[model samples]
Target: MLLSALLGVCLIPAHSKPAGEQLGSPLLQTCFEEAKKIVDDAYKYSREESLRRVRKEVVRPHDALRLLKQPRGGTRSAVRSADYMAQTLRLLQERVHHVHKRSLNVTDLLSEEDLNKLSEITGCASQVTFPSCRTTPNLNTYRTANSVCNNIKNPRLGSSNTPFARWLPAEYDDAISQPKGWDRTRRFNNFLLPTGYDVRQVSNNILSTTDAGVVNDREYTHMVTMFGQWNDHDLTFTPFSPSIRSFSNGINCDESCEKIEPCIPIPIPPGDPRLPTGRNSCIPAFRSAPVCGSGYSAFNFGGEPKKREQINALTAFLD
Candidate 1:
C-alpha cells in the first residue's frame, strides 16, 4: 500500500512529460525502508514490527516537520515538491493506522501480481521501466502510439498565472478537433475570457472579424482565452474583467436593454419550430434575461458592417 501510494505521488513516465522531480527525498528514504518491513514476509503479523517500523518511520510528528523544513524552500518547485512530500507522508501514516486496526496481511493488502509489477517498474537502481508488450496487453500502440494526459510541473516558481502549463491534449484536444463541422451551427455559444492576465493590454480594444468574446459567470458561461490570438480588438475597452461583460447602456443594464444599445431579443415565440423539438412547453433562449444583443465591438477586424454582422451572429447563438 505504501509503495503504491508513494509511487502515485509522482509516477508519470519520464517519456510522457519531462518532470525531473524526485518525489521522495534522501531523508524520506528511511521511512520507506521501515514501511517495507511491516509488509515484508519477515515482519508480517508482528505488532513489534508495526510499532518500531511503521510508526517510527512515517507516523511521527517530528519527521513531518523535518521534511517540511528542507533547505530547498526558496524555489516554487521546491515548495510544491515539499507539499507533495508532506501530503504523501500524511497519507502513508493514515494508511498505517487503518492497516494496523484492520490487521490485514501484506499479501491481502496488495495482490502478488500488483506487487511484482510495481517492483519491476520501480527498479532497485532507482530507475523506472516502460512495460513491455506482454506486460501491457491493454495498450495497443503498434498502429497508434499510446499517449496519456499529464500535468508537467513548471520549474518556474512564483509566477502564479502560468505556474503549471496544464496538458490534456491526448484526450481533450483530439476530441474537440474531431468535431470538425460542429462549430458552424453547432447549437452552442461560448465566451472564454481568462483572468489574472495583464489587464492593461486589452484596454480600448475592438473585436470584429478577428475578435472573439470571453464569457465567464461560474455558471452558464465559459472562461476563454484568445486561442487564436485575434489581434483586431482590445478586450479592456469593453472593460474586460474576469467576469461577465454584458450589454449595458454605460449607466444601467435594464435601461440599456430597453433601448437595444447592444442587445436585441431572440424572437422565439410559442410553437416556434426552432425552439428545441419535442418539448411540451415553450422555452426561450438564455436565463440571464429574455434578451439577446448585437454584440458590437470597438475593435472591428476588417470593416464595419462585416465585423458588426459577425458579432451579431455570435450573440444570436442560443447555447
Candidate 2:
C-alpha cells in the first residue's frame, strides 16, 4: 500500500500481473530495498538512530504525477500516514548508521556511487508529462498606488489552516521543527529567490523596499497540488470564494441571453414578501446559463483551453 501510494508503478499485485509488466521502476525498487537493508543493518549492528526530518521542496512530484496517470485512490487515512512516517524514520536512521560506519560527519564526502545515484533519480523528470503551467501568473513588485498586496485578510470569518503561521499558537515552542520567531517572516533572499535571480532595491525618504525581479506579480498564484506518498507532508488546501453580484436599475437579465434571448415570465415565488407596490402574480426569475470564462495561459500546460470553472478552481485553491 505504501509503495502503491508513493508511485503507482504496480497497478496490481506481482502475481496478478504478467512477466512483461511485473514490477515498478528498477531505480525505485532498488531504492526501497537499499533503504530497507540499511535500516535492518542499523538494528542488527547497534547503530545510532539520530534521525531528523528537514522540510524540503522536491521535484519528484513531476514524475509521480506523470506515472500515476489517473487517480488510483484518494488519501484519507491517518493510520496509513502514520505507518509511512514510521518507515521514513527507519530510512533516516539507516543513513545515520552509514555516516558512522564511514567516519563521515558534516565535512565528510560521500562515495562517488551515492552522488551519481542521487543525480540519476532526481533528473528523472520527463518532458512528456507535466510540461508546465501555461497560464503562469506574472510576479511583480508591490506598489501602494496600484493597491498591490499580499498578507491581506480573508473577509469571511474563518481560521487560517495553520495557526502557528498566524501567531495563534502561543504555546508553540518547537524551535527546531518550527521557524524561529524572528526568522519566520524573514525569507532569506538567496534561498527564496531562484538561482540567477538579480536583486534591486526601491526606496523612498522614509524606508527602502526590495524589488528584485518582475513588475506586477499576480494577485494570487494557483497551482494544482496533489499528494501521494512513499513520502509526503501536511498541506492545507485553501479554496477561493467568488464574488456574487446583485444587478438592479435597468439591468435586464430576463430579456438578455443571460437568462434567455426571448425572455418569458418565470415564477419568482407565490406572493413574494419583497413585492413592490401593485405587482401582479409571479415575475421573471431571469435565470441564466453559466457562460464559462475564456481561454487563458493560466490553463494547465499541454491541455485543452481552460473554462470558467477551472479558473475558479485555481482561484479557490489559492484562496
Candidate 3:
C-alpha cells in the first residue's frame, strides 16, 4: 500500500497545458478567447488615450479641431497615432505570439564560458551559479572591500565592510593591495585619488595656521583616524561617535602635563560650555592666559600676572 501511494504521488501533473493545446475542451477555448479580447481592448484604450494627448500638443489649433470633428478612418482628418497603431498591430501578430510562447521555455541565462569569465573577473574561489549571484544593493562595494581587506596586514589600517559598502569601486580594492612606499599609515591621497573633487581647492578650504604644513600632533592623529573611519570603513558602518578631542591640553590634565603639546586652547568668553567652570568661573580662567600678539606668535603662559602691556598687545592683534 505504501509503494502504491508513493507511485501515485510521483505521477501527478505539476503544470497545466496552454489554452491553444486544449482545443478539445470547448469551455477552455471560449474562456481563452474572452481573455484575449479583454487584453486587446485594454491595449487599444491605452494607445488611444496617449495618442489623443500627443495630437493635442503637436498639431495647430485649426488642424486639431478639424481632425477632432472628422470621423475616424474616413481620410477626412481622423485622429490616428501611427506609433501606437503600429505597436498594437505588431503585438497582435500571430508570429509574435508564437515566438513569445516559445521564449518562455528558456530558463538558463549564462553560458559556461560566461560563467567562467565572471568567476575569473571576481576571483570567486568556488563555482557559482548565475541565479545565486543576482545583483543586490551594495553587493559590488562589499565584494571590493572584502577582497582588499583580506590582503592587508594591519587590521586597524585596512578598510572594512563592517558597517556598509556605499559606492566602492574595484580599483580601491586593487590599490589597497599595492605597496605605498616606506610610510605604513594609510593615506587616501597617496593611494586613492578622489574623483569630482578638486585637490588644491580642498587643501585651500581647510583652515590652516601660519605654520602652513605643520599640524599639531592631536590634529594629525584626528585626521588619520577620521580618514580611516570615513573612506576605508565607510562612515555609515562605523559605530563610534564622530566627536573627537584633538587636543592634548584639555581641561582634564591632572598629571605632569606641563610640556609643550599640540592643540592651541582657544579661550572663549565666560559662560561658554566648552571651558570648565571652577570656584572662580570660566571668565577668570580665560583672563589668566596672556593675550596673543600681532602675527602668529606662540601663546605666552609664563607664571606672571595679567599686565597692561599684555592686554594692549592682544587688543592690537584683534584690531
Candidate with top TM-score is 2
Name every residue pair that clashes in candidate 3. Answer: 163-237
Error of 2 at 233 (Å): 19
**lDDT value, candidate 2, whole model:** 0.25
TM-scores for all predictions? 0.15, 0.19, 0.15
List where candidate 1 sits over 4 angstroms from the true fold: 1-129, 134-197, 203-319
User: In model 2, what lDDT does residue 305 have?
Assistant: 34
TM-score of 3: 0.15
lDDT against the true structure, per candidate, is 0.25, 0.25, 0.26
lDDT of 3 by residue, 1-319 (tens): 0121122111122133343342122222222233334334433543464357446747545334322432222111101111122122222232223534544211122233432322232222121112232343454456433232222343212222111222542232224212222123545655644421232234435643366776568446777888765553332221110101111122311222121111112222333333453332211101111112101111111122222111110100110
Residue-by-residue lDDT tens digits, candidate 2, 30-96? 4444433433443322212111111234433422332232111111111112112223223323443
- Which runs of model 2 end up more than 4 angstroms from their true locations? 1-31, 34-92, 98-131, 135-174, 178-319
